[model samples]
Target: MSKRDLTDKGTISRKYAKKEILKTIIGYLVFYASWMIVTFWLLYFFEEIPHFDWILWILFYAVVIPFIVVLVSVTWYSYRYVKMFSFEVLESDIIIQHGVFNR
Candidate 1:
């Protein structure tokens, strides 16, 4: 048996990039939504919790805003990443390589 080199500089289509980015964003949202629901429930369940009301606002601004910013940044980068990525499927092996440092 001989190994075949199926590697080619395949182009990354726009539709593929959009699909991947949307999938990533949806995954992030699903995880974030569940965690936020639990957090809100805990915050509301506790009665007469001192300073909790103020803490809620502080945590929302400090944590949530930064997360949203980072998520957007990551999605943008991921679009570029897909553009620069490569996949190889050989007769007996498969490979995937991705990076943008040298691009």
Candidate 2:
């Protein structure tokens, strides 16, 4: 596609693209750090309790699985958001488009 066509279709602004990339990186880093800390804390806590295997298993399914699901969802959503949403600064006005179907 031509540059004009791409811009008109809201392919994205360079500034916004960089910002979004940075945001995604920072979010993942924070998520991983928090997950590690929480995992260690839970392991230590469960170790203190007698016969906590069941509780550990329960927590694995309830907390860990959901946490993983949420992380995956957020990553996928962010990727979609970045791909689908874009801004174009025209001389007359700013143009924004979101969603592959609509565009």
Candidate 3:
């Protein structure tokens, strides 16, 4: 469609390109997967320390709780972010709207 048509207030808003969405998803998967791997490694490493059972307890809470909370929030936020995101081209300007809770 023409930029002019997109410029109309509510006439046309386009979502992100497929390549962009795929890239974003892959990036997230890589990041979170690495995080889990490192956390598990740390837990295993700490198990050998003397009297570090306390430390293990602390790590459990520090890693698991925050991981769950952050993961869920990020998932929800990204879903909303992608759903709400759009761009429009005007005659002399471009408008992009993104984000969910923070936008």
Q: Pick the candidate with the highest lDDT.
A: 1
**What is candidate 3's TM-score against the reference?**
0.44
Best-matching candidate per TM-score: 1
Error of 1 at 92 (Å): 10
* Per-residue lDDT of model 2, residues 1-103, tens digit only: 3345443444644465456656766776677668757876887888854357876776577566866676666667656666777666555665565544343
lDDT by residue for model 3 (11-73), tens:
222243344445656666677568767866886788844356875775577655665666666
RMSD of each: 6.1, 7.1, 7.1
Error of 2 at 55 (Å): 3.5
> In model 3, which residue pairs have backbone atoms overlapping below 3 Å?
none
Query: Alpha-carbon error at 26 in model 2, in Å?
Result: 9.5
1-103: candidate 1 lDDT, tens digit per residue: 2344564445456676677667777776777778767776787797535486676785688567866886788778767777777755666665556653342
**In each prediction, how many residue pairs overlap at the backbone (N, C-alpha, C within less than 3 A)?**
0, 0, 0
Runs in model 3 lying further than 4 Å from the true structure: 1-52, 97-103
Each model's lDDT: 0.67, 0.62, 0.58
